[model samples]
Target: MLELLGLSRVGEAVYRSMLANPRLDVGALAAETRLTERQVRTALDELADLALLSPVSGDGALRAVVSPEVGLAALLASAEEEAARKQRQIEQTRAAIAAIAAERSAGRSGNEIRRLDGVEAVRARMAELALTATRECMSMNAGAADRPDSRAASAPLNQQALERGVVIRAVCRESFRNDPETLAHAHWLVGLGGQMRTVPTLPMPMVIVDHRIAILPVNPHEAAEGAIEVDTPGVLAASCALFEHVWATGTPLGDAAAAGDDGCLPQERALLGIVADGHTDEHAARKLGVSLRTVRRMMSDLMERLSAQSRFQAGVNAAKRGWI
Candidate 1:
């Protein structure tokens, strides 16, 4: 036990022996402790170094053993002070590391934007944001959120946020209902008290946590590249506004998206608007989170329903009927 105060076992034994038998010399201490005289003398030197042994006045060959209550207490107090100093140093080092990290991040894009270089990095940042979120987590995702792998990866983070009583509101494409697995995942989210809504198309994928930070794809057309984290108040406000505007026009996950009076589903009407804007079928498929084949099939059906011979005529006919 005394070793913790920097006393060796041999020194501790010699000190205890000297304390209990104050009249004993080094030779006698060695015999009592079953140690050699040299070892005993070494312990005496150790004790002297620790100020546990003091010379007796008028007796050059004799030394007095300090009481444990005094010597050990001083040693313990020194050890405690050393430990506290180390703790302070550790805290300072931690602060320095945080500052260095912030500086490195800011060097890339002012403090308002941080670039995540890969998919793994983006996921890691999102997970961190989810863990630290205090109030709400809102997201507008394209088709990726409906993929089995993406859903599996996000389940735990979503559950953790929900369990923390964070309000989670998500918007995805209405095309997710066509896939049974995606629809089941949507139901699971709703069952957990999270709000799930769908729109005909999403402009981009984004996540806003606590209304403070927003994560957006670096390239909306190529989401797998990476993402950027934004904390600028103006950007966050715009992101929140975009989410709210889309949310206001969304169909809740539990309900079916009703078609307009023109016999075109919202997605179908959205397809018409995209065609009218002169976007390719591939672009429309990407925006609607559907396959190119599906987009072509919808276009063909629309053309047949409108009795139009060509794509341009279909758009004209649909507009005439107020379908657009």
Candidate 2:
């Protein structure tokens, strides 16, 4: 227990032995504590340094143990003072960081929305944002990139953020589960305490950090086109609202898709909604991050279930039954 106050085990043993019998010399202490005489001597030196052992009057060969009440209380008080000093330093450092962040932010217009012209620029800005994020990291992906190199590059940063106790939430298309590589990445992220959820479709690829900075693709369907960085309060609020809405409706990763109260799974409902919007099977497939064949198969099963002969009839039937 005294170790917390910088007391070594040998020194504590020697001290305790001396406290029990003040007349015990170094040899007697070693014999009693089962430590070598050299160890006892070392302990004696340590105790003397700590002011726990003092020379006994008129006998340089004998030593006295300072009462633990006085010696330990002094040590405890010193440790507390050191801890307080460190805490103050921590607070000062935190304040300095806040000041720096604020000064940097003030230099930029509060409502500025800057365009990042190329993928490299976007990647560089993203790295900067990720590095400075102090709170939550949120993102919505229309689909996984499924690029091993990109995933490998991002793993270290993601792991670092997670280790720093940052909260991470991501929403991706459920069809990513169909791809082995994407599924593995999602599982790996979740295993590291990062949260992941899935929806049938996402509007676009977007990232928001600390609820203050947002990065949005220039084109909803093509992230390679580049992105825009926005710190506008209104835009950030809207972006956060959209994320929360999608997140609330999403299924947790690894969960089995189940039918809703309307007798249609989320994927089925999303497909029906997409078809109702006059999109082709290919368009729906792209939005859902699935293959055209999968979209067609799902449509076929839905039509059979509705006992409708055509897509239009199925839509009408679904509407009448409140399935869409």
Best by lDDT: 1
Candidate 2, residues 111-139, lDDT tens digits: the string is 89899987788878877666567799999
Location of the lowest summed lDDT over 10 successive residues in candidate 2: 143-152
Cα distance off (Å), candidate 2, residue 71 = 32
Tens digits of per-residue lDDT for model 1 on 1-324? Answer: 777789999999999998999889877898999999999999999999999988887755758999989998999999999999998996687467557655665676534778899888998888777766769999998873465677788888788779869999999998878888888888888899899899999999999998988999999878789999988888998999999999999999889898877778989999999999999999998889888999999999999999999889999999999999
* RMSD from true fold, candidate 1: 14.1
**What's the lDDT for all of these models?**
0.88, 0.87
Candidate with best TM-score = 2
Predicted structure 1: lDDT: 0.88
